[model samples]
Target: MSYPWQKLGLNADQQADSVLAAMTDGEKFAWLSGPMAIPLHKGEKIPAEAIGSAACYPSIPRLGIPAIQQSDASLGVSALGGVRPGDHATALPSSLALGAAFDPDLAETSGKLLGREAFCKGFNVQLAGGANLIREPRGGRNFEYISEDPLLTGIIAGHNVRGIQSQHVVSTVKHFALNAQETGRVVADSRLNEAALRESDLLAFELAIEIGQPGAVMPGYNLVNGEWASENPFLLSKVLKGDWQYPGWVMSDWGATHSATKAARAGLDVQSGSNLDECAWFDHPLREAVARGEIDGSYIDQMIHRILRSLFACGAIQHPAQRGTPLDYSWHQLMAQREAEQGIVLLKNAQQTLPLPPELSRLVVIGAHADQGVLAGGGSSAVTPQGCLQLEGVDFMGIQTPKVYHPSSPLAAIRRNSLAKKVDFVSGDSIEEALNSAQGCEAVIVFAQEWRSEALDAQGLDLDDHQNLLIEQLAAVHPKVIVVLQTGGAVTLPWLNKVSAVLEAWYPGSGGGEAIAGVLFGRINPAGRLPITFPASEQQLPHPKQVDPSTTTSLPGVKVKGDIFQIDYNVEGADVGYRWFERQQQKPLFPFGFGLSYTQFSYDDLQLCQSSDTVTASLTLTNCGDRSGSEVIQLYIRPTSGRYPSRLAAFRKVFLAPGESQRVSLRLEPRVIAQWETTKQLWHIVAGEYDIFQATDAATPGLCGTLTISAHAFGYRVA
Candidate 1:
């Protein structure tokens, strides 16, 4: 008696159901909870040094189902047992850097490399492809996210997912809904109205799911509206499953689960806990709930089914999983270097200070310990290089800060590439020392950095380490001062007017040193753009202060007493980043999609054509300068009928040579121009004249063309 699913040759869903039928109640419950405590090196329990098995899922040998082995792969494959000598993974630039690149092809390449590296290290599931939008600049996890704009974030993260999945490894796009900040994260409720949620945050997830087809999703630690994301029915069941029809299984962030029955019932398929914390919420409690009739057996079946479905769908079972395999470190390093080069945005280049003149004799490099290696963002995304030192202190969770410094030396690279014979260095030993070193130098390059990570929000937009004062002092003394910022996201530049040049290198990865050298010496043209708006000050932000009376902090063994933080997202609606700044008529230090190349480009021949549900726009771009470079052509839609003030519809990164011209056509998707109507609970478009702008940056209305939609033919997509 062959089952219908079996006769159909076992697709993922069907195979999952068949496996569910064979699973006993105990087996099903075991499958739903993870990081099974297997002995490490013949010990009875997991070793203290290795926090949790790199990945774990119980094996059902009878069913020929292998245990799922996954690793935290946000940046690269995380050093499973910490970054010991000769233990390193490719440290790609931060996701925000990739966002700045505004190139999905690079994002896809990154995802593929991530998958290959994780697979080589014996992992089948990759906890990668984080797509949370940059709602707050000071948000600690900003480095891990894609961009502030939903369309960009969704598209980039989607391509990343495609690259990872192509390697036959399950990729997880995560922190499921409205996890915009790290302060009061565990208990904060992201309270947004239905319309706002649908348009911005949820829309990003929806687009990513449709494009990427990821195998797993990790719901965040925060609460959506009033409910925890792990147990939020509207978010997990209705939005993710019911509406978008996401095929992936949903997992909880380590220690994110509160209740087994609630989470399981609300559509959370697995509870992946940390080895440091022995309590598995979805394990015994779920089994007991089933025994006590608190949770139906069908929910347990669904949980197991989702996990197995992803494993089968991603071909993890079909491929061989191995550990400690040798990798092409040099090739990966070179790619990481290229990613850094493509993503570093030249914010300001006054006086032609950059592409440093060949006649330069003396040059000074200051701060960020540039002689060693470039800095990296902290938290789960921090990739420990081969020779990195493991810091002694631990965060709230027993996670160590990676002090891994890759061997890419800025001083060495600059000396090797530049014409400057005398290159001086200042490690911020003292203001006086830095000042002395800067005297009479042809040019001064100051490298400033901000240390950001999980479990903590930046104090404010101000550069820490009094680096602002240092830049001010340097600019005051030196005629030509270039400030190279190594930050996670946007930072307030107090000395914006003082610096001759400003480059935003958001945690450039291992190859960052060479990338920076290439840009400085005119070897590579800077093409990266700002993924988020850089406010002049925190006063310009929608929420001037992210923490309020409702906010409270949580630590490993510390107790907190206060009302849970209520982060109101409805106040601004879908006005995130540039949208918020635009509505307020505030001036930002740097606008979104803003980047300066050594060569200039011109935008012309703006054309717009529309159908009932889609719009096609074309424009011409020409490199006006003598050098060849790349430009990101951004398309925005401003509906006269009053939806969003402006939204990014589509974007294309184009490369052009000297005196070269190219005509580019972009297809605007229906959702890009549609508004989520709260009353009707549907996506609707009002028939009106839409202004289409092909611009260099958000602040510039480069070449505007209007296209009118027929009133009688107005389209309402019931998504």
Candidate 2:
């Protein structure tokens, strides 16, 4: 009566026999094909039968085991029937906001929250973490991605994974290996040299594995080299299972399995989101491989064993599944507010212009998204929120204020706050009329949100005319003016000098109002930094569309805009982030890792180590300024030889008391210093000298030391 899974309660050998005996080779094959659908952000058009009643355990019932199911995870739970069942949890700020926060512990908490939500939703498996570096600004899925920096992405992803698996839910660290860009992701071959991929794209995934140790790795949709990711034996069997020792099951991306035999042979233990047809497994290539004794019943059993191990490890097989109750709009709303508050970045605060004086006699607020909370993004990660906080802030505040529209903005939240004597709503009126209406106002607030996409790159770096006009008009009437940006990503700040204050509240979730209010009133300090570089102008970037493709448009419906590698890496080369600007002696509006806090921090006690095998550095960090704050210590390594122009070596986050200082260690494996010799087309290392820097920002590599690396270690050609 006991099933093989039940027998798993016994000793290992017995359990193995129990599982093997219960299932015939065919049943084992069925279990070996254990793959589930990855629900897209856009709710699926499901067949009703599979909705309320899931297709439970075909093999598990027969052999007494249960299969696992899951979903993509840019934000939280994917909605169903236009109802968000999981909104009771917080809709945390997008990954960019979290990255901007620059606090790993904060990122850890965010991940834990997401994990709790997943646990509540009865999801056995979820794509909880993976570092997909945002190589392109126009990357369609930028909101879901962390940052262009590998260290930041890895840290954030590791936090997220640690949170999920701690709740006993299997987390998939995914689009595994190299999947930096979304364009032609399914079919395009990533023409990457090993050094490029390893240092930039693949580094994060490797670091996540080293730290997070997730139970599942979803191979990408694209072809890695010439072979599909699903069937790349070199990648899966060699790199993943052999070298890295990743014992977890390898699941193909949804609809990403290119072939059955090769995929299985390559170490793909599960085919995710496959249609319920046995043809893929039972058909020609795999069957032939089996008949020829290349792959057999044992291989099939082993594959199922890996999957079952994952389920058991995550406690999905034996634990009592407690599905959560229906979603609560109010809880979701509050979560949105907290996230919005954390997400609001105080970019500039000249003359102490913010926390808009509570003694205001009159006020004018402006932007469209101000009232319409940015619920979600477009492309693979899009999902409709149950309730948004954009419109309701006014009535809650019980304040008399004017709601002025500047196309799209967050002035609505400001309008609802206290101290406004008379409220007036304005749209497209002349500057004279707008200024006249605000005659008695002591200060003005401008709401600016940038909405950009791969389909249409930013026309220019500047804010819209409506926003420009609104700021120019409002500043004339009121010497004190503050601008709040509610956008998916970055924008130029031409009017930044003109405004007294600037807040980058990137698409704050449902609590757009309360969160903004909290930051504005100094209830909370704005610590969010710009995850991506704010371009000085559109011309500053290497435009993909401008290349010699001579193409006006792309495939219909949805399409990735440009080759991120081509634009960001090849053409732009090493001139990325503060690296490019500083190297060229050009200035950025705000440098990478630049964020002004209500408090201040300082760095000291620089130390550098140069061993034969490694280079290490350390620094003493102190919060010299008032408020309790955190600072990210950046490390850069530059080889004296031409192997690498420059690269991030190591980094650490230090939190300090006002005037309290402590020494922290920074480490670098000499391997990180290895680079490719482009002329000879081989990886190279030099025993010659290299420079090390410990600094606040990449541009300001303030403290420096020297070391040398052996050229022999890296002198090898790629096959």
TM-score of decoy 1: 0.93
The sequence of per-residue lDDT tens digits that candidate 1 reaches over residues 473-559 is 999998899988888788988889988999888888878889998999899999999999999999898777766334334322222
Candidate lDDT values, in order:
0.81, 0.59
Q: Which candidate leads in lDDT?
A: 1
Q: Write the per-residue lDDT of candidate 2 for residues 144-211, one digit (tens) a residue.
A: 66776776677677777776676666787777655544544565554455556666666677677777
- How many pairs collide in each candidate, listed in order? 1, 14
| Runs in model 2 lying further than 4 Å from the true structure | 1-21, 24-59, 62-64, 80-89, 275-299, 325-343, 383-385, 389-439, 452-478, 510-512, 542-586, 610-615, 640-645, 669-671, 674-688, 707-719
Model 1 ranges off by over 4 Å: 1-9, 35-44, 47-54, 80-85, 274-279, 389-396, 548-563, 710-719
Error of 2 at 247 (Å): 1.7
